[model samples]
Target chain A: MIVAEQKPIDEIKKMVAPYQKLLILGCGTCVKTCFAGGEDEVAVLASALRLSFKKDGKKIEIEEKTIERQCENEFIQEAASCVARNQAVLSLGCGAGVQDIARQFAKVPVLPGLNTTFIGVQERPGLFTEECVGCGNCELALYGGICPITRCSKKLLNGPCGGSQNGICEVDPSVECAWQLIIDRLKTLGQLDNIRAYIPPKDWRSSNSGGPRKLVREDHII
Target chain B: MKTSPSNLQKTLENGKFAVTAECGPPRGANVKVVRQKAELLKGVVDAVNVTDNQTAIVRMSSIAASAHLVQMGLEPVMQMVVRDRNRIALQSDILGAWSLGIKNILCLSGDHQTFGSQPDAMNVFDIDSMNLLRMVKNMRDNGKDMSGFELNEAPQMFIGAAANPFADPFEYRVIRLAKKIEAGADFIQTQCIYNMKRFKEWIRLSREEGLTEKVYILAGVTPLKSAGMAKFMNNRVAGMDVPEDVIKRMEGVPKEKAVAEGLKICLETIAELREIKGISGVHIMAIEWEEKVAEIVKAAGLQK
Candidate 1:
């Protein structure tokens, strides 16, 4: 899922300070799952902003609303009346969500309230770890499901790179060496020979290196 | 010798044990530092390796420093790391270095930026060390760029790569060495050796796999300045293993006598390295202590 963290309250306040009437929007998909932006978070932020503004002797009205997913127009249409009534939207969603909202309501200013970190998984109860880079070319099968491109510090194909010691990465002691994980997994799967074969230079054209990528589903288009 | 005009290549091809020392470029644009180090290493070693932004700290460009070495009548093994530049810059520097009369090149996946002065800098590991080796070899042998465009004139370089015998997944080290040889490394210079047992085991495996016959193996040796340095490397430095016994040996000496003790240990390691069958030569990395390299070479009886 796309992981995100909410912007500091002070920064969010500064961003919405110019508006007399503001709508605090929340995303109920990836950001909601990560607890960064959701219905509960929006209500808390709205109350905090109201109190913060009142203490400053300012007259500002704030409204709270959350959609199923801000990226889609169907959910965005549900909030049309609320958005039209407000002067600006403090979107507590991922970067994509803020942009999608901006595109849908062209005249309204949609400000991002959360920072989109990475496409990752919730490793534990609250800990999130990056698992994929969306490089467009998936070679996970060869590496026993561990993505070296995303995990390894050097992104080395033929690696470990003289930096792996005792299953730890030289880059940081806390991070597990990706090559160690690859080697151990391959060994368990009886596919240790997979790593022995030299992987040629990666064709990065499929990655972001080629530029901003666009995917079109011709078969699904109606 | 046919592959490159590198003096180191010629010496290795002639079946003579070669000697190479590392010369780290200064943090600032100081030509005098490079020249002073060059003078100390002039007749003591076959070729001097000019490090490229070693430890990820910004330094004088390795290509520029190597060109300076060429002007001083010293052969330089220009070190290029994958952490700084992409293919275009790497290829361009290769051509530029060769044009300046530099012959040898060492391909390395440099030290991570977090270890250097600039921890906030973004790295450009567009290609790994293996890719760099293959690319250099291709440009030299096939006379074509990575994109298959025929170059007007390709750089003929003696390609070298680094190895860490002490690193983990110990059984896989030899396999990686063989892969490096296949990827087009003419020579392999290992990380500093303190754990001789591990180094010997790695070499034995390499010998069994016939990797020794395919590429020249230069065992790396660095003289420990003090017991504190030994302890620091053992605990802090990643991928480097300094055994407790070695640390004890250094600590056993007085503080004032530690330098001499360090040199003695280094000389002893070189003597032991000479006895190893598959070992081709020694790469003395007297980091910031380049003057000791001359004394080491002379004391090891490797001085020409």
Candidate 2:
């Protein structure tokens, strides 16, 4: 899932300072799961902003609204009335969602309230770690499902780089070495030979290297 | 068979004990400092490495500094890090550096942005060092760009990469080296060597894999300026293993003569490194003290 963290209150306040009427649009999918831009978070943030404005003797109207997913045009259409009522929208979504909202509501100024971090999984409650870098070519099958691209600090295809101490990366002691995990997993599966194969350098064309990516489906075109 | 005008490559090819040095470009636009440092290393080393925003700190572009060095008649290894640039920018810079007569390129996965002045900065790690090596190799060998498009004229670059022997998963370090060689790395410059025992073991394992014949391995060495610096590197720097005895030796030295003692230690390490079978040369990274390079290289008897 796409993970993101809320911007600091001061920065968010400054961003919305110019607008008299603002809409805090929340994303229900990725940002919702990450607790950055969700229904509850938007309410909490709106209340805090209201309290802050009230303390400063300022008058402003702030509305909280969330859609199923901001990336899709259909979901973004649900917030049309709120977007029309407000001078600007403070999108609490991933980068893609923020852009999507901006594209859909051409005249309204869409501001990002969350910093999209990475595509990761929740290791446990309240703890999230990045897992995939979305490097067009996926080689997880060869490494026994452990991605060397996102897991290794160096993104070494033929790692673990010299910094894995006791299965922990030298960069961060808390972070487990991706290669060590791969080795262990491969060992368990009796697939140690898989690692021995020299994985050549990856082709970054499919990644963000070329430019912004676009997916097209001919069968679903209609 | 000749391609680049890199003296470092020539020295390594001739089976000679090559010596290279590193110089971090100034944080601001000060080409004079870079020129002075390049002049200092003129005849002292085989090539001078121009670091790309080393330690995540913003500095003058390595390519620009390397171009200046090329004009000064000094062969420079243009350090290109993956942290600050996407593939588009990286390829463009590589081509620009080549057009400027800069031949050597050292690909590195730069230090994370958090370590630098701009902690809030977004990093563009479009490709890692290994892939950078492959990209450069393809551009040089196949005369094509990342998209398999043909280039008007491909750059002839002597590609280099970095290795940290002191990093964790010690046993896997050699395997990584082999992979780098396979990825088209013509040479490698390692992280600073303070723990000789571990480095020797790494070299032994590398030799067993016959990787020594595939690529030139230059062991990195940095002279300790003071006991505090030694302690800082030992404790704070990730992947750095400053030996306890080396720290103790630096501590044993008097305050006024600590640098001298450190230089002596560096000389001894370089001498010992020359004896290691797989070790081809020494890469002296006299950070911020480029003036001491000539003296250290001369004292180490690496001046050819």
TM-score of each: 0.98, 0.81
**Docking quality category of candidate 1 according to DockQ thresholds:** high
- Candidate 2 Cα errors over 4 Å, as ranges: A2-118, A133-137, A151-180, A187-222, B1-5, B142-154
Best by DockQ: 1
Using TM-score as the measure, the top candidate is 1
Q: For model 2, what is the alpha-carbon lDDT of residue B278?
A: 79
- Model 1 per-residue lDDT tens digits across residues B1-304: 2434688988888888899998998989989999999999998899999999988889999999999999999999999999999989999889899889999999999999999999999988889998899999999999899999998888989999999999988988988898888889999999999999999999998988988999999999999999999999889887889999999999999999999999999999999999998888999999999999989999999987
User: List-wise, what DockQ does each model earn?
Assistant: 0.81, 0.39
| Predicted model with the maximum lDDT | 1
lDDT for each residue of candidate 2 in A1-222, tens digit (9 for 90 to 100)? 999999999999999999999999999999899899999999999999999988988888999999999999989999999999999999999999999999999999999999999999899999999999898888888999999888887676766654566677766778898988998888789887787756655777788766988889999998
Error of 2 at A52 (Å): 6.0
